[model samples]
Target: MMDNKTLEKKAIAAECFVEVPFFDLDPMNIVWHGNYVKYFEQARCELLRKIDYDYPQMKESGYYWPIIDMRLKYIKPANFGEKLLCIATFKECENRLKINYLIQSAESGEKLCKGYTVQVAVTTSDFEMQLVSPDILKQRLTDYISGLS
Candidate 1:
């Protein structure tokens, strides 16, 4: 078990609260393993929103940041109707966008799952991947990180 603050926000982070719905459960009465990715996406959206760079903004900026890889480690099972706290922390933006996630029981403060996703920027027009992330990402991260303090 970990404290609630263990996954607390940092300079570039966001937290999302989600309730385990009946549709998200499996026959075994626990959260479906695949649904954890959705949970991470929710937190990731919040994190990107904090930096004023949601999907729409990405499209408008002429780039598409696609998730290239993901990894998850399930620590415990989450039951339906349980309150969950999902945390996302932005980790990198130079070559790719990397965000780490943590999902825990809101009531018991126990870790349920942890993972990370990596995204690389690709030009929307030609679908060419950028070797380095566009300057906008770094600038937005810098602005958000500075504003946090």
Candidate 2:
């Protein structure tokens, strides 16, 4: 198993500011743990969009990538109306795409939660598993990285 520091090394982040809602709170007036998963999903999708290669595009490309593994760890509690920023980073792009996540208080920068997800590519038409991701994904990453240079 990899440690948090090690996982952070393989990520690309998309920061999101979320306003906690009344329904997101538990009986304790803190954000419910399950709600964090939604935030993670939101940021993950945004990060994929940054690369112009998200779920819809993946399917259009004749592939289907599913979340095969996921994990979350809650460190602190956030209350209703609290603004929090979520960072979704890419952890791995080889074999499968792994993403690491971090949620922190927008005001105090206190870490609220951390997690990771793993997704594997599969053929959409025949449903055959792909040992390597499609070339479009690799090309997009390459172009995105080059644009930064």
Q: Which candidate comes out best when scored by lDDT?
A: 1
Worst 10-residue stretch by lDDT in candidate 2?
1-10
lDDT tens digits, residue span 44-140, model 1 = 9999998899999999999999999999999999999999999999777778888889999999999999999999999999999999889888777
lDDT per residue (tens digit) for residues 25-116 in model 2: 99999998899999999889989998888899999998888899999999999999999999998777757888889999999999999999
* Candidate 2 lDDT: 0.83
TM-score of 2: 0.89
The regions of model 2 sitting more than 4 angstroms off are 1-11
Off by over 4 Å in 1: 1-10
Per-residue error (Å), model 1, residue 116: 0.2
Question: Per-model C-alpha lDDT, please?
Answer: 0.88, 0.83
Q: Alpha carbon lDDT of residue 141, candidate 1? A: 72
Clashes of 2: 3
